[model samples]
Target: MKYLSDQMLIEVYHRAVDLQLDSAFIELLRSELDHREIRIAQVSA
Candidate 1:
C-alpha cells in the first residue's frame, strides 16, 4: 500500500466497489485511505 500512488489507491477502491468485493477487503482499502488522510465523498460497499 505504501508503494501505491494515491491515484492508484483511488482506482483500486473504485474497482473494489464495482466488483462488489468482500466487506473486509473494502474496509482495508478504507483503512489505507484513512491512514493517508484521504477522504472519499462516498463509498457504496
Candidate 2:
C-alpha cells in the first residue's frame, strides 16, 4: 500500500465529494473529520 500526503488526501476527498462517490450519509462523516482536524490547534491550546 502507498501513503498519501494530507494535501493529496484532501484533494481526493474533495474530488470524491464533487463526484458524489460516497453515499449521502458519509458526507457528514467526512465533514466532521475535517472539522476535527481544523480545530486541533484550538483544542490543544
Q: Model 1 — TM-score against the truth?
A: 0.88
Per-residue lDDT of candidate 2, residues 1-45 (tens digit) = 026555655665566666667555345545554764732222110
lDDT over C-alpha atoms for residue 32 of model 1? 99
Judging by lDDT against the true structure, name the best candidate: 1
User: What would you estimate as the lDDT of candidate 1?
Assistant: 0.90
- Ten residues in a row with the worst lDDT in model 1? 36-45
| Model 2 CA deviation exceeding 4 Å by range | 24-45
The TM-score values for the models, in the order shown, are: 0.88, 0.47
* Prediction 2 global C-alpha lDDT: 0.50
The C-alpha stretches of model 1 lying farther than 4 A from their native spots are: none
Cα deviation of 32, candidate 1, in Å = 0.3
